[model samples]
Target: MAMPTIKAVRAYTVRGGGADYHDTQGYHWIDDHIATPMARYEEYRQSRRSFGINVLGTLVIEVEASDGTVGLGVTTAGEIGAFIVEKHLSRFLIGRQVTEIEKIWDQMYFATQFYGRKGVVVNTISGVDIALWDLLGKLRGEPVHALLGGPVRDELQFYATGARPDLAKEMGFIGGKLPLLHGPAEGDEGLKKNIEKLADMRSKVGDDFWLMYDCWMSLDLNYSIKLAQKAQEFGLKWIEECLSPDDYWGYADLKRNVPKGMLVTTGEHEATRWGFRMLLEMDCCDIIQPDVNWCGGITELIKISALADAHGKLMVPHGSGVYSYHFVITRHNSPFTEIIMSAPNADEVRPAFSPLLLDEPVPVNGRMKASALDKPGFGVRLNPEVKLHRPYAAA
Candidate 1:
């Protein structure tokens, strides 16, 4: 006889920070949703300047049946953690077995069908998928990355993200980029300052070190062209998000203008594999940064890398590199993944941050390495005692 499926799936959003966060009672008791009190650890995790900013406070889904067998999942939703579970996909996940992840994902897609696919719905699922993978890893005594296909690289090189020219060089990361920060002033003085940052960084860091600058979505064709011309003096390795997500023509034009060696990279907000394929077809980007959680999990990441390889582009997975580290380590010659070092208390979620999170925050001497872990799954272990704060409730 077939075993019974998960009969009831209830989710509790626990906060890890110290002290208690008052729940809006009016908001909490709607349907099967409930909130857990806050703890000190969680506040640090969710804090604007926490080291464990991105990876902590995952949504945990408990898959329990009347027979008592249980499965647990940890997922990423950035800051919108419980909202994803209690408000969005939690109800659809009832009655799923530990083995029914693919089916559950489909069910979630169907349930949230009215919201359309992408953005928050997809982000919520990304976290849920992470939780499922983690739960499975715990059940099997293996790390999530190991289950994905088995560990490959010995160490994952990390590039310090969110650095400007001086900070980038000072941190000893010769291989990273700074997000775009410019004002509306256009012309010679503005151009000079723009060019100077890159020039100064390259001068300080020396040659052979990779450097990138983020244009964000602010630059148009003229701005991109001007910046592209100025960037050559600094020998920038790549320019990220130089144009808007919708401006494929801008990329095409900027690509032609930015000389041959400087890479034009984008697509952190581009959704999934199909979105990436458009970039490939248009030859828009020399490097692709498909965020695995939002883009598509392990299954789709490999497919994306394969597509890039076939087309002579490299897949430099973006977003939370803590999780992306699994993908980076597995792919050969893939270098310089983004590391957004916030959440001051990083050790709360990723204990590896000590020796793992570099002083420079990139590979050693600007050549970081992905360390091998004896652990079974993603090599990340969570402190269950830590909880979530400010749980979202549907009123």
Candidate 2:
């Protein structure tokens, strides 16, 4: 028997909240006065959109096999990612065997090494690599988990990330991670309000609900330490991405300065095994949170997950819809996964990448059965009604 080869690779971009969850129109909790690196500047302090966080939009990649099976991937690189896929990365996929994921990934990475290693370039590669995995799974007639090695557990549990942990509690999540609303630029009053918010949520959800703060790379080391120390009274379970991804030394120091038993976590923006190696080797964090969409896709993620497991660290992937769900169920170290409640007020559960993906599964009461993902490939389809723009093409 012979195998099918990839025939054509296509790329498109979408606007307003798909994979680029920040590219939204009306008020979204994610874009609200959440503390971020740009918050230091008074002009961009009110909303993440002011700093053009949503400029990239969502990049959609599709790989069509010779057998007519097509695999899909979505990420935040938008039109720039589309250009990379069509103008540059498409050659690596077309005419290759569908099983050549690893080879193709290597080629894409090193070929774009000079201009691409992280950021949008790596994001493009990640999207293409993810499409390959989805294509392979469909061709093999198995769910992605079965292709990976079968699920270690019957279902996946989730923790919700949003502004309203109390509502998430009512929704049955194991834990609720709140976005930090204040930063160092706000001074002591900002820090005080930060603790006050946590204190209020604590009082609402009670102490045992497992509350944590997601600083979103907005804090300096000193301010993060101050916030963590104050949050200890509310039994803060973790403090995430408080500093820039490049600050390994600061992360290590923050890890040491945090209250005993309070976990320090980062890496939603970090890419590749080499970048993660720095985090693990430096003892920079207690757990690593990689977004499969942004962290080199399933191909590199498998390697990154192994590295964390070997170092005795948990790899709780960032909230990335079904992408995180498929991989988390197959690993022991991934005891639970994340869901960034996309509901306007975080008052209800909604598919993380809503409207862009059809048949995309959302957790029922904070748990998703392995069977929900039993369909071939990633078990979801790109919503045809959602307009797709092809900005570049290969001749």
Candidate 3:
């Protein structure tokens, strides 16, 4: 059995809800008055869009094999991501063996190391790395999970990230994580409101159902401690990404100061093994939430997961559609997954990357069967009806 060689690599970008879930059009809850770091400024407080959260759009990467099978990867880098793929990263994969993913990933990372260690640069590499894995899965005629070792669990249980945890509770999720709506700038009154909101949701969902807050990197150390202390009364399961991902020391201190049973988690914005190394070694968090799309794809995720597992921490990934699904089902450290409710009201389940991917699976009653992911590759196709713009082309 011979493996296929990479034939061509193409990059494209699209707008309005795809891998870049933030690049949506409408009055969705994700873009609502959710608290963010930019909320300190009164002008940008109302909507995250005002701060350009959706400006990047969606980056789509396609790696075509010699046998004509094309593997796809999507992320939130948009046109800038396409430019990196077409002008810089493609050179690493153009003529290599499709199975030579490790070498290609190494080259892509180190080659762009000077200017690209994190942010959109790593995002582009992540897209490329994911595409390579998808290519390998298709070439091998197995799902990415099977390629990664095999499933350790029979199904994936999910915790919903949305505004309506009450609704999610009715939907059968293991838990619901709400976006914290007030930051330090809002003062004590805002802190009171934050507690009130949690109390309200707890009243609806009751005690046993897991409830958590996603601060979205919108709090300072003092404010985070205050919120966590208040949230403990409602039986909050965890406080997530409360401070900037760069604040490792702050995260460690927050972890130490948090209520006795509650967990302090972060790392969704951090990237690579090195970044996670800083988090784990410092004991900055109880769980590490890496978004597969943003955390250097499954290739780096494997390394990060191993590190976390060794450190006795959980690798609970952020909401990334099938890319996270395939990886989640296979790892022991990944006990459950996170799904971002896309509907405006979070009442109905929508594909995480809706309108961009066809045949994307949504959990039934907040649970997805492992059997549902039996298809080759990542088990979804690009929605051809969606427009993909190629911002740059390889010569």
Give candidate 3's root-mean-square deviation (CA, Å).
Answer: 0.7
Off by over 4 Å in 2: none
Tens-digit lDDT track of model 2 for 1-395: 57899999999999977999888889889888999999999999999999999899999999998989999999999888988899889988889999999999999999999998999999889889889999999999988988899899999999999999998989889999999998999999999999999999999998789998999999999999999899998899999999999999999999999999999999999999999999999999999999899989999999999999999999999999898888999999999999998877889998888889999999998899999999998999988899999888875
Q: Taking the tens digit of each residue's C-alpha lDDT, what string does model 1 give over 120-209? A: 566566656655554556556665566666546666555655444445445555465655445223446655776776677677677876
Clashing pairs in 3: none
| Tens-digit per-residue lDDT, 230-289, candidate 3 | 899999999999999999999999999999999999989999999999999999999999
> Candidate 1, overall lDDT?
0.56
* Quality of model 2 by C-alpha lDDT: 0.92
Each model's lDDT? 0.56, 0.92, 0.93
Better of 1 and 2 by lDDT: 2
